[model samples]
Target: MTGQDTLETGESVRYISASDLRGFVAALFEEAGLPKEDARTVADNLVCANLRGNDTHGVFRAPTYLERVRNGLYAATPRINVEETAFAARSVDGDNGMGAVVGTRAMQEAISVAGQCGTSLVSIRNSNHYGMAAYYVLQALEHDMVAIAFTNSSPAFPPWGGRKPFFGTSPLAVAVPAGKEQPYVLDMAMSVLARGNVYVAAQAGTSIPPGLALDKDGRPTTDPKALIDGGTMLPFGGVKGAALSMLMDIFGGVLSGAAFAGRVGNPHMDFDRPQNVGHLFMCFRPDLFMPMEVFKSRMDDLVATVKRQPRAEGIDEILIPGEREDRSRRRREKEGIPLSTDVCEKLDAEAAKAGLAQLNTTPAPFAGK
Candidate 1:
């Protein structure tokens, strides 16, 4: 939802700077019981999502998180323990910690082990929503590794045939290095759109595009509120996407010893229960399979070829998977992130509860320009 509208009361919305918003969130987490480092990490990840134009996974989720912490559904100081196994694979028990912190730590371990054994697989259980999967996959780039990351969440959609929800809006991310151009990164959910997107649309009083979601009775719906309440998100490309989601559930959830989609409870509205989300991370040292230089060169060539493809009548340029997001991130980092009025209100309430000073109400230098 675009943050452009005037309510009946004729009040205009204000946007908060990304840094200020993140600082406010960090302070709230600190007050809620997270350690300084953990709080900072979570704050950075959330803000990064906003900067990258992924509002669904961004600071917009702060209110629900705060509510979860307040209700004891999430522990501020969780003990993240690792259980090692053969084949360079490991299992991580997040102990109900913030997903960003747990995901970062897990990817670090995967990178380290992959450096030694050529490849490593790490499965994590009991973590919360870790924001964008790209965040973790990109972490492996510095190590000259190809990274793959996946996560399974509460059921927001059904399996190919079934009416009831049975699969999480699972996401998959892959990152490949490039020589001169930006790294080739692909991050996408198996569903047509993320559940958070629907919420944002609903809050802004907008209707979603048709065929993206299904109503409570399993009929196609365009109403965001209906999709948010009991509706199910449609899988991308029908059965193919649903199949991939199931595979992600197996690799991320079952392998991590965490509950599957239908088994895991919703964390957004349910503040008193754990979500038991799961994630899988894999990193491969390019040198082990092929020369790093060769991989990077091929990736650069591939990206250039795709961008050179003919465009449609109205299209000016062909875009790569992560190109738009990377550009958006650079722009937002220099300017500031945007927030809807509802999100701003929630942030203000959270800041007050944590005894943090209110954020500046001025719009970011780059907003609406």
Candidate 2:
């Protein structure tokens, strides 16, 4: 699916205010069965995706999640249970709850434990897609702790050599405190690009860059639809990325005793089955390894030094990971999140099907600027 395939000629796009969208999604989740607080958490996470320019995992996924809930695949009232041990490690059973809610709870638990133990690990099983991994890691930053987060998803890409899909676009995120600069964050999937990026490119009728994905038969292809239909995504930078992805799978999937990529069901296509996704979270109090003040000052110096490097001819400055995203988020929060015509239509259809009032398409408060 390319841009031309989805966008009609001369069709204009409109923006949706984040607060309105967040409220609507929260209402939808509550109507579908989640508790009010849990619904709010899930909605916030989903909206954050759009705010950060990751529309593929944003509200676009709500319809599928609702369908799964209605189909009895995901429990409306989940019973998340935890098992703790002596090693400052814990395991949580999501009991088929919304991944975002469960993941947030897991991180909360990890942070709490880390405060007591100086470091802690939490693994979650039987969860679903949890939106961006960075959101959960950032939660620990408020506690002045360094954090790591990982999650496994449905099989969308193949192992390095094999043609068959055997791994999810497993992702890892890390956050570290800094003194003067913004907190340092790194979040990325092992794949060359996120599946959401491929879908967005396909919707825009654009060819993906080379080396991103392969067609169904394992041949490299720039067409986005090829990636959607039984194609494989290449790992970033070859073997190293693949190795990291495998490691994430082990920590998030295998260690959590949850289904790995091949065994986990796809949420997009398999509406009647639980995704059984897994996640790993860890928090390390800076005071545990070094003085919090010293660590933060060092991080601030590191960021400043990197920003001082020579830039390309047209570029003014180099951006560390999460810097640009943080800027975009602040701007969008005040300006509103832009939704392409295609996404707007999809949201409207979902509203109609769910027997809810349609979102107003008129220019919202943050539309123009």
Candidate 3:
């Protein structure tokens, strides 16, 4: 089965199976000089984002990633090195590796250390733009450990009072294991929506809803391309989102000796130099205070209590955080991922440039073969 969607611009979208998408992306990366394993790692991360309904960070980014790797701005096979700073704290240098690869290794290090020390923090520097932050947290969940992830990007927004691009639309994710209910997974961006959302709109040639962005002169605008050109993204809730974004920079960039305070190079725009992105990953044993099963039971209770509460007007039901994404993942697993043809065409062009075959996509939506 497959899916399709229509955009305001009249561009049609179709579904691409996860395996086919992964194979296409991996083959493109391999053709661009990445090792087979590293290419698949990157593909998996991007496809997982798509499956989880985070299209802004999904395979839509293949062109930019391939460009960076081919140009040497992003290291294809980086020499990842880790330095132990404490029993439970480690610092990692990614050697400008692909952000997904760097992040996967760093989180694995965190899981290993937390297994031995009950808690661990692994700070990373010199990485590229990692995809959705939840991927790492989910990795920790597979090991039955609670995890938190933070990463700072190239600055694309402003602080509370200023309009100059000063803060990255930084994001953080957290996950907790549960016994009978779905695990708690939360991924949030400081901005009202990701700047990548604007890029997605721009690529589709559609107008964004008003007030999500401001022009360089601080006037509200709805033009996605305009926002990408010289405008800034509005942080959600004005000051609070700005504050959390700043906090992410402190944890992910400042502490890790990576670029911060509007200095991290933009992964898409700053091709002249490395992004030098930073990430902070923390994991802890859920059984630190009680039996693992008991902890999971409490988590299940937490979710049940929330779901049992009265629903708000027009709300069908109260859903725990990550439930929507979990549902999307399950549905996509069965019905393939819906991707805009514009994005598909771009990916196909990139594959052609690398002398690889184009991606396979379904023409109709959810039609049984």
Q: Which number leads on TM-score?
A: 3
User: Scored by CA lDDT, what does every candidate get?
Assistant: 0.83, 0.83, 0.89
Task: Please give the ranking of all candidate structures by TM-score, highest first, separated by commas.
Answer: 3, 1, 2
| TM-score for each candidate, following the candidate numbering | 0.93, 0.93, 0.97
lDDT of model 2 at residue 33?
A: 83
Instruction: Encode model 3's per-residue lDDT on 1-369: one tens digit a residue.
Output: 223466355667788788888999999888888999999999999999999988899999989999999889989989999999999999999999999999999999999999999999999999989999999999999999999999998877899998878899888899999999989999999888787788888877788888778888888889988888888888889889889999999998999999898889887798799999999999999899999999999998989999999998999988887999999998888888888877888888997787877777786655466
> What's each prediction's clash count?
0, 5, 1
RMSD of 1: 2.9
Q: Which ten residues in a row are the worst by lDDT in model 1?
A: 1-10
The 10-residue segment of model 3 with minimum total lDDT is 1-10
Clash-forming residue pairs, model 1: none
Candidate achieving the largest lDDT: 3
Q: Roughly what TM-score does model 3 have, to 2 decimal places?
A: 0.97
Per-residue alpha-carbon lDDT of candidate 1 for residues 10-90, written as tens digits (9 for 90 to 100): 334456677787787888888888899998988888888888888789888887887887888887889999889877998
lDDT head-to-head 2 vs 3, winner? 3
